[model samples]
Target: MTMATYKQIESLMGTGPPAGAKQMQVMRWASKNPPKDPNASFSGKNVLITGSNTGIGLQAAIKFAALDAAKVILAVRSPAKGEEAKQKIIAATKRESAAVIVMQLDMSSFESVKTFAVQIQAQVDRLDVAVLNAGIAPPKYATEKTGWESALQVNVLSTALLAILLVPMLKDTAAKAGRPSQLTITGSFACQYVQPDELKLSPGEKLLEKMTSPEHFNVEKSYGQIKLLTQYVMKGLVDDYSYDVNGQVDVAIDVACPGYCSTDLGRDFPWYIALPTKLMHLYCARTAEEGSRSLVSGTLLGNAGHGKFWTNDVFTDPGIMVTSDEGKKLQRQAWKEISDICKQKMG
Candidate 1:
């Protein structure tokens, strides 16, 4: 690739569009020449992936099944869709019965989240990898039943609650098997590029109004803020709590970005923008298989000393934009606010 093209790809990687355009070009080139051994196996593991019915989540589920995971739980919103995704995986991997099981989960509802957690606790003795992969990137603003913004609740709050509820089962299973459990949250590069001021919704404001507000009008920024919040929560969970009374550490939590790939995530954007975005992704975005590399690395390939973030099978900085003093302060505040909201809702 020419220097200009390389710069474009890098800019796209950083800001999702023009700013990271060079990085994006490089990523496109890299995808064309992916590593020969992209199919790392995970035999004998029990894995759960939220939103496993479509897009990146579905791809991740298929990859895990191909790796021979003992059980690949498809935690999804629709049973029919979940079954369809499961069938697709089985056919693709040629796995036998019981390779993938569909479980009902609606991240938008706190009750639904708790119910899913309880069901999981009863049915599974251990969870080797929990991929918090389900998320929404709505073009128009929306709110859940609880009146919280849709993106925030689904992308950040629900994910954190699921981890909190499932942490014990993960800990118990890991302890018995004498292994370290792993939790991976799928974040986005938007986290670093978007401005923080656009994240909050005014009290009692309509979702659409909030979406159009001068301060919070940008869809890309809103999505990025939610992701930044996710990384904050993931990091805080592993670092804040002391060793358990029994002196056992909690499961390791790591965050990763898939960069940008061709997926239904941006389907709701205006047609003019969405069309070009889709075309660009088709030509440049990493294949679903390649997009999942950092996620898998953060989970199974991570080591004792591995830091919180991973990309392309290596520990790389999340960059000054995401790790700066101001950024860290915002992250800290976001965690506390989310925790408080969760306590009130989950109570």
Candidate 2:
């Protein structure tokens, strides 16, 4: 293994026992287990997966192509990398005409997001499943073009914006097709764990300092906070638009945690931290193909329970932090703040 990979795995193994025991158990179960339905497919489905150039996103795209999606839009930041990923999928599936298309989207930029949405609106009449899969983990400390904290911007704010912009299209598609359209957000177990009070950073505060100085300053907790906000926003969307007066669209919004898979998401950690993480990833981590199962289940297969959190086909409660009354209020406040930011930037 590369030194970076080795170090991540080593640190994870050395961190006493696993801090995420529940997550570990779910991973083990998924690793040894197979999907309940082996012959599932998504024939004639239209799927849009963001950040699909590598890691879990790439794997999910491949799966969608193999399952016979009518069109799989590989929404990615890097056009070159997206092309490479498309070729890999074509080679693996031997389906040259799988209708895989690449669209540019940098979730960190609201302008990019608006351009992407406009492109989709022009090209496609409706989107069956809009999978919000692209995300950046906690960067050392940075801000986006709009001066919002990077993690919150990329992980929470951008995701909510895209969903909002696409809802009308999704609803239109579902209305015409006579099926329930879906919005699946790939959340993390962290959402349930992070404290709600620290959802956003005050102006000029370093992102890393804000994250680590909080009483629960662990990496996972910070990450979880973002995920929690995503889920809460998702629930809010479902409540607001899942149905019309007569329940026309029935747009289902749900979240799922892809149990930590072996991906390059943690490549920047120190050697002590990165090595053990790599090992655990190798030994215990689910393949990206497997990781996409919950996502596909929630989005395409209609396996998601309405507004619930899922992993490996089972419905599990989100973090205690999110389920509490305080958590819900914080989620609302965060959403409004993000919406205001988007409005100002777009205007």
Candidate 3:
């Protein structure tokens, strides 16, 4: 593991869930107050959001459009649905049809992600904000065509790939706009719930390799673990590439947690799991629109939010795994593995 600076290590210490934090989060959810709509305007700015066809992504697209963004690109796996979502955003915002563009983006496939990136490069002049919100919570173990576990593939692998690919465009836009461009990746509080023992591995066994191995898959634990890996990727991006030649931030990269919103993310859950989750949603989950506020606010944080995790309208600790000694080692290992995969795939 690479040596992290003392400041970096200190930043993570004591930041995140204390003892019995998960229970406290659930209690807060029942009375969870929605974020006040940000007064910050995106007028004339172009924005893009993946998985915008449904859930918080769709709701977030509506918010961006209503805020007067020049263009709100809905990048989804299904164009037909993307178009439907476009209409919804337009109707909600009273924005013109031309204000929202639907683009195909299959997070399950690297080729598809690459194609989407190329399309963005070819068509858009400048992207002021991008929210990589496409992800899944599969109840059963499954692999995409890439042979990686579905959650790991979309939530961590392709997400890392897309973020890195979009950096140059974000940097270019920041230079022209005289403000840092925002690239917010959707993350979750679940990231903090994962325990070190849960991820115990054999000697020299790579964390990602073990997590993605079908023989070792654990549906109940996979989502949190994958989200944790996504946090690692976000940190790696900020540490390695977000700065300019003069050390000023070029792109403001950060993670946004939607706060366990009531969305279709659990639609595929087995009855056993789905029943409890639905009940929990009814009891405590935030509305999809309410959850989306974090994504919008996250993008507007500018340089102050770089490399930080934003949740519930404020920046907070990402959890112990992101700060502890053993966890930092895992963070380095996960970043090395994920970055290598992204580079190979991008090549």
Candidate 4:
């Protein structure tokens, strides 16, 4: 039998298959060849992370608390789980009075997202960094609480809605502070695996309905399609976030990937896929702590990071296909149509 490395497996089955090896090449490189130094503290900053109950988000909360952040809000589907995660973070960091708190946020629901944003506006004086990190990978037939496919609701629609709601808050904060505030959408390597055929539909009233139909359901392709659509939302709306409601550039908005990490995002994996995946997680996946470092580093970038896709602690091409001339044309066309749909659908 041929032994499987990350790349070898990807070559055989596009991005993820055999339900194991979720592309560890970037993470393996990041782990073995770590960065030169620790990026510095987030002291006095009010940082918020969605899905902070476990995995990379949990690690990020710990580090920000250790750095003496004024507030570390855990935005999660369950306040109970968020509180539990907060306790663990306090125990790990021993940062008593870190002001780490749990705020309920169900990313699959538009109502929940709006309420969370309003609560932020009411309570927090400033938001130094907002990390949009919650996401899901559903089984072929899974659906979110909102009735859309699980990947579509949790990963794209609700997440984008929350980002749009938070824009003014980030902008107002940037305007108040000399430095620009940050809004980072946790991105994925899945963005690299898309093809034009996957999104070749012309602008039409029913395009979203057509694309998301169960008839198009293919387990292997669903997750990547969600990530690709997410990138489009990031690219399409990032510019708007850069400028405030007054149209002055006061915030930095970008997407960041933590590479492949062992996380609960794959909670929906079937037993067969899940069993072998445990082995791959042990050998290939970056520990959540290691992955979280990449995400936290993104909040520290300057103007160079505006509207860019960041990974491995650097701003680099999200994909060849996403940046090519033809790609640019496609992105623009997709953005024009999708933006309108997103506004209408999200409303």
RMSD of each: 7.2, 9.1, 5.5, 8.4
Tens-digit per-residue lDDT, 219-274, candidate 2: 54567666777876777677666785695546778886677677888777778878
lDDT of 3: 0.85
In angstroms, the error of model 2 at 223 is: 1.0
**169, model 2: CA deviation in Å?**
1.0
lDDT of model 2 at position 328: 70
lDDT of 1 by residue, 1-347 (tens): 35653443233232122234455664675556442233456788899999889887888888888878899999999999999999999999999868788999999988999999999978777798899999998787777886767887798888888878888887776777666677888987666555545544355444333443445635756776677777778766776531356755557677866666777877678998798887887787877666765565556543342236655444455645457776676566666766776677678
Poorly placed runs, candidate 2 (over 4 Å): 1-27, 34-38, 195-220, 301-304, 345-347
Give a tens-digit lDDT track for model 3, residues 1-347.
12342333233232233335565564364235665556567898999999999999999999999999999999999999998999888889899998999999999999999999999988788898999999999888898999898999999999999998999998899899887889999999888788888888889898877887887678878888888988899999998879889999888899988787899999987899899988888777889988888788778776667899887655677778998998889899899999999899988
- Among all windows of 10 consecutive residues in model 3, the one with the lowest summed lDDT is 8-17
Candidate 1 ranges with C-alpha deviation above 4 Å: 1-26, 33-40, 195-217, 241-249, 304-307
- The whole-model lDDT of each prediction reads 0.71, 0.72, 0.85, 0.73
Going through the candidates in order, what is the number of backbone clashes in each?
A: 20, 20, 0, 0
Report the CA-based lDDT of candidate 4 relative to the real structure: 0.73
Per-prediction TM-score, please?
A: 0.84, 0.83, 0.92, 0.85
